[model samples]
Target: MNTASPTRKPSRIQKRNRKLILDAALEVFSTHGYRGATLDQIATCAGLSKPNILYYFTGKEEIHITLLNGLMDTWLAPMREIDPEGDPLEEILRYVHRKLEMSREFPRESRLFANEIIQGAPRIGPHLEAGLKPLVDETSTLFEGWMAAGKLAQMDARHLIFSIWATTQHYADFAAQVRVLMGEADVEGGARAHLDMMFRRLLRP
Candidate 1:
């Protein structure tokens, strides 16, 4: 007999609590990976009761999914910024620089995503198919166009993109190994210079 009413927007407190939970969850997920992370750990990190954390997110899986879903835009923005009309080498190098900067600044987010993918992305597979695949396809097409015009070296565009991702993300994903190998040198600056030089040489026509 009664009709369902519309849902109200979250209050300021609710928004703040949600952010706190997400921040805590990112730290936990990045450190422990999805399988190792626990709700109690997240609740303690967020300074919320288990029930309160559950009030914001249904469970650990939901929290992990929410954190990852939110990260997709930020993660893919460099790819999205690739301009077809701009100078091809410059555009690609700029995208590389932005990605390296993201690695330095948001390593936690980077590791969280890397962990999800390493585990076969069971939670995020659908989102990747729906959101990530199209972007990669579009970028690959642009790379192919540049190759056809002799603006870039002839190569598989998708593999080129994959190479860029692997090279740039290695700094974040294997940061500990890099530190151990590099000793006390300037890691970030050195990586930036190395990546810029490598891509410029690789992409030059």
Candidate 2:
């Protein structure tokens, strides 16, 4: 793994180059899908040579895996932000809005993750099972507690989360289709309002 040593801090240049490579790789992987993406494409995109890319990453798979793992964190951040002590419906609606913002701002990342999952998540399934599942289990328990206390509408907490993911990520993962159907309209804004209304109605006590 091209990891920084625990005892040593990476210099500014090293951090910059690594970020350049990863950002380029995200574009390539999102555009081509993992199986179709290549180190050469990433190198070209990064404006770096293959050797430099290799210096930062081992190969295409390593870059892809790194991107996927990092994306899991980005994907899970909003969920992690949920405040158990906050108002339940607002917290959940805030999650919905944050996810929509991610779809708008991180469309490429959304596509990259969607592609990985669509292809059976061969590169990142383990991370999903290990990281995503636990957080989801905990969130589900939280939702269950809220419902039991009459703070939320009773429903399958797991499916509620799944529904939220599907609805929000659709804007990013299916952007081409969305563009074709909706043209250059303010899609994210519309989605935010719609999702807020939908979830509010569904979850409000």
Highest-TM-score candidate: 1
TM-score attained by model 2: 0.94
lDDT of 1 at 198: 94
Candidate 1 backbone collisions, by pair: none
lDDT of 1 by residue, 1-205 (tens): 1112257677788889999999999999999999899989998999999999988776788889989999999999989999999999999999999999999899999999999999899999999999999999999999999999999988898998888899888999999999999999999999899999999999988
Task: After superposing candidate 1 on the true structure, give the runs of residues whose Cα lies further than 4 Å from its correct spot.
Answer: 1-6
Return the TM-score for candidate 1, rounded to 2 decimals: 0.96
- Least accurate 10 contiguous residues by lDDT in model 1: 1-10
Q: Candidate 2 — which residues are off by over 4 angstroms? A: 1-7
lDDT (Cα, tens digit) per residue for candidate 2, span 37-57: 888888999999999899887
Clashes of each: 0, 0
| lDDT score, candidate 2, position 108 | 98
lDDT value for model 1: 0.91
